[model samples]
Target chain A: MEIIKSPDALKAALKATQGSVGFVPTMGALHIGHKTLIQAAREANDIVVVSIFVNPTQFLAGEDLESYPRRKEADEKICSLAGVDYLFYPDVSDMYGEDEVSLIAPDVRGYILEGTSRPGHFSGVLTVVNKLLNIVRPDRAYFGRKDAQQLMLIQTMVKNLFMDVEIVPCHTVRDSDGLALSSRNAYLSADERGEALKISRALTKASHLVGKGVLESDRLYAEMLAVLEPLEVEHVAIVNRAFTPLDTVEVGNTIILVEAVVGTTRLLDNVWI
Target chain B: MEIIKSPDALKAALKATQGSVGFVPTMGALHIGHKTLIQAAREANDIVVVSIFVNPTQFLAGEDLESYPRRKEADEKICSLAGVDYLFYPDVSDMYGEDEVSLIAPDVRGYILEGTSRPGHFSGVLTVVNKLLNIVRPDRAYFGRKDAQQLMLIQTMVKNLFMDVEIVPCHTVRDSDGLALSSRNAYLSADERGEALKISRALTKASHLVGKGVLESDRLYAEMLAVLEPLEVEHVAIVNRAFTPLDTVEVGNTIILVEAVVGTTRLLDNVWI
Candidate 1:
């Protein structure tokens, strides 16, 4: 795989490339989740491009911008092994300037659940994603369903902006214990890792309850809250595909989401029913 | 010219065509200015697409959105005569939804001058322009320099977002009497139309002064304001190409801008030195 650092260079490279391009954008420190996304991209297109940009704009002031994992060599190896055609690794300067035309997330959909806690986070994600998508000009872009809200918003952006790329959502990849794989998982201590399992456990419990014919949203929320007991849970939201509040679970349409703090690190996991 | 009223149809149409597309986006009034833009596109690309969308978001509340002049038949004829291959004329519903992923212009540059007077205007312009660009996916997009700030902001958006299209800046078209051609000129009465000529005259005066070697911004501003005397001049700005206020004209890198209210109609004109 050829690693490209500049946006202009990537554009030039892609211009010469034939056939459909599939892209998987990620922040470095790749795991099974990122691999799944990359694998999906690899299977679908003639050219596969993976971008490892730990975009600074997506992190809020107090967020872990500095401490975010960066394993460039390992990420390169992963992309090469996964058969990536281009690995875009750009500096913050290469992607952004002093003043920029930024994106604003939809007020309603973009401000609920994850957006409520991280107010401007989706906007940052959107701005960088937009830049990346334009730079790659992929025929299809792969995203893991682990970031359900983000995936939804990105899909919305693609539709609303009339962007000519398909968004392919791969299922969330998880560890044996069901902890959704995340780069932030690196921040978890040995004991904190054990605590993080409760997040997936809560989501599993919600899924089980739904399987047992418990469809009411309040009941699911209560049962999940019990599973997440004694943890500083940010929210245990049960919403439909649109992220709109649901009175009762809609079988294939509902998502049971949970966010909790394990030690100082926050972990998120959700199960789509 | 083929008139495509849906984005999907336009995209499908363009997909079948095997050549470079040049685009000109306008609010339909079929003026000489728009004709100039379309003509430029026709000369430069294998296929030319012109969109006539009076984007509602760009117009502030209480603005003349409802009263905005739209001459569909004339616009069709104009596009046909200008050798446009496709004319995309999507409805508001076709272009927007209830909630959307919108764009926000840069705080400093976007909220000055025209943006200051019409808050969130550039954001609206950026959003619509972004959508249109994505829908058309042209090789080169034509924009008149009459809306100088708008043109600059669009260029900035294209650069900052790493959009693929080249923004071709066309010279501002003017009437024989030196009045800048605008769709909004339809709103001006005969007397107001004559008054609007002073805006271009003031810009002309500034250009002549610069020709005589008066490089100071203050001197240019004073001379332009004097020529615009007794008129309700909004601002007489002497700035560099980047729209930053200049102390002294940088010869090849200066722009003299004038905005004045001709009766109830607002008119704008500028000259690049």
Candidate 2:
């Protein structure tokens, strides 16, 4: 596959293509999760463009931006294996500059749960995503539901901004033990890796409870919290598809999310019923 | 010309057209100023789309948003006369919703001059302009040089966001008396209209000094200030095309701007050398 580094090169490459384009944006250290997104793009569109940018803006101060894993050589091999047409790898200078206009996330929906723990995170995601989307101009863009809130906010941004692209949400990929695949999972030790499973377990438990007709949000949250008791639970939130908190869970319109610190690594997982 | 009120209808209408589109966004009350923009659009592209939105976000509290002049019939007639293919007229609800993401103007450049006198004004302008640009997806969008700062910022937004549209900066329209044309000119009484000529006259004086090799910015600013005497001058700024203040005038790369209040009406005028 073709590896493009500059925005201009990618633009030139995209312009030369003559069919529907699909895009998958990611931060590099590819896993099975990323592969699934690429696979979907490969099957649907004549041209597939994947961007691997470790966006510094999305990471809060004192976060792991400095030490985020980078497997450039491996990533290039994976893209070729995945049948990618163009792999866009832009540097920081290629993406941002001094004195730039920025996108601000919605105040109310942008600052709860994940946003509460890491303020201005979604804004950064949105700003970079907007830049990428404009640059790529893909007919369809794939995003994993692993970041459910992020997925929701991005869809909202596309609609609100009147961008003419389809945002396809793919299901979250997990390990055999039900641990959600994340690049940050590299930070976890063998023990913490096992502990990370508790997050998904909590989500699975909440899903099972909902399947059995336990509709009260408070009870579902309490039961999930019990499963995540040993870990440092950041939040156990039950909300509608719009991310608004609900007193009672409504099946097919509810999502249960959990975030917990297992050792030094922060892990998150959610289930939609 | 076909008039479209809803965003979906406008999208459908735009999609049905199959050629380069030229867009002119305005707040109705069509005059020679708007006619110039539409005429330029008509001459340049196969399809011309005009949007008349009195954006509330761009108006500050008690800033006459509710009382802004809107001549719908005249505007429609003007568009048809100018050979516009479609006219988009969306209500506030069609453009905005609860808990929406927004665009923030650059901190340093966006908060100077007109932005200084009216805080957060450019932010609103940038936000709405971004929305309109994305919605219409025009091949070329036109703006007047009368609002010099606004034109510059919109150009900056398009460049920074990597939006795929050309921004054509048109010459500022003027009356026989050399007064810049503006819809707000409708608010001025005969005396106020006579007093408003000072703004353009100041710009003309600055132009004359630059023509005579007066290179110092302070000298140019002082001469312009004298021309705006007895008027409540807001600011007299000498800057490069980038809007950064310059110590010495640079021919072909300079802009002289003036803003003054005549009675209750605020008037602005500028010249690019």
Candidate 3:
């Protein structure tokens, strides 16, 4: 696997390659979730390019901008093992400049859910993702369904902007105990880690109730809230595939999402029906 | 020449084409200025694509968007004569949707000069240009230096966003009497058309002064203002290539810009050293 850093080098590499390109963009400290994305890209395309840049603009001032995980050695090994054609490890300088042009998220949908919890987060994600997509010009870009809102917004952006790339949404990968894998998982202590399972448990409970014929969103949400008792819940939303609020669930198109403060770390999890 | 109206058709046309593509994006009503851009594109690339989209997002409320000229028959003839391979003509519905993701212009630079007169104008221009550029994905995109600030801002956007397309700046095309050609020229009455020559005359005086060793920006601006007498001059700015105000002109890197109202229509012109 070739490890590249500069944007120009990656562009040249992409230009020299002949077949369909698949890209998986991430921040370092790769987990099984990232592994799944890379594996999917590898199987689907002739070229698999993975970019590992800790984009600073995506983090708000008071957020974990400074303390975000950076395990370069481990990330490189993971890319090598996964048969990545190119690993684009660009620095902050390579990605951003002073007072640059930005992509603003949609006013209404962008400020709800995860965006409401972390203001300006989706804007940053969309901006970085746009730059990455323009740089790579891949045939298909892989994103994890674990970040359901992000994946949806990216799909919206590509469609709205008329960008010529397909967005492949991969299923969320989780731990054996059902906790969704996240880079922020590194920040949790053993006690917090155990507490984090409640987020996933809440979604699992929602899925169980829905399977047993409870289709009303309010009743399902109330019962799921019971499963997440004593935790500081940010929100428990029941929405359709378009992220629109659903009072009554549609069997094949429903999504139950849960986010909570587990100790000092925020954790998110969801189940799609 | 092939005429395409849908985004999907343009994308497919671009995909099927071989060799370097050069693009010229305009808002219909093609004049001599647009001709120069197309000619440049024709000479430089193996294939040439031109898009005529009067993007609504770039126009302010109460602006001339409704009254803007639509010369589809004339425009098609011009493209055909200029040897354009494809002419992309998309309507507002084909270009925009409700509550879409957009590109926001830079706060400091984007809000001055043309942006100062027309608030949020550059944001609309950048957004639409970004969409058009992505849709076409040309090797080189041609832009007229007539819209000096717009050209500069587009260059900055492409660089800051790491977009992989070359922006070829074409010289401003002008009439024999020195009025810069514009689609809005159709709006000017015969008497107003004669008065518009002062804009170019002012730039000419500034250029002459600079050639004779008068480099002070303030002194040069005063002389240019004198040439634009009996007119409601908006602004006479002397700046370097970076759009920074210069006390003294830097030969080979200076630009003197002028904007004035001739009767009811507003006009803009500039000269680069």
CA lDDT scores, all candidates in order: 0.90, 0.91, 0.90
Candidate 2 chain B, which ten residues in sequence have the lowest lDDT sum? B220-229
Candidate order by lDDT, highest to lowest? 2, 3, 1
Considering lDDT, which of the candidate structures 2 and 3 is the better prediction for this target?
2
Q: Which stretches of candidate 2 lie over 4 Å from their true place?
A: none
Best-matching candidate per lDDT: 2
Taking chain A of candidate 1, what TM-score results? 0.99
* Cα deviation of B255, candidate 1, in Å: 1.0
TM-score per prediction, in order, is 0.98, 0.98, 0.97
Tell me the tens digit of each residue's lDDT in model 1 across B149-252: 99999999999999988999999888899988888888888987877778888888888888899998888888888788889987888888889999999988
Q: How good is model 2 by TM-score?
A: 0.98
Model 1 chain B worst lDDT window (10 residues): B258-267
Tell me the tens digit of each residue's lDDT in model 3 across A23-130: 999998899999999999999999999999888878888888788889999999999999999999998899887767899889877888988998889899999999
Candidate 3 chain B: 10-residue stretch with minimal lDDT? B259-268
Higher-ranked by TM-score: 2 or 3: 2
Docking class of 2: high
lDDT string for model 1 (A21-71, tens) is 999999989999999998888888999999999998888889888999899
How good is model 1 by TM-score?
0.98
Interface RMSD of each candidate, angstroms, one decimal = 0.5, 0.6, 0.9
lDDT of 2 by residue, B1-273 (tens): 899998888888888889899999998998999899999999999999999999998889878899999899988998998899999999999999999999998988899999988888998999999999988999999999999999988988888788999999999999999999999999999988888898998888888888899989998888878888889998999899999999999899999889888887778889999
Model 1: how far residue A190 lies from native, Å:
2.0
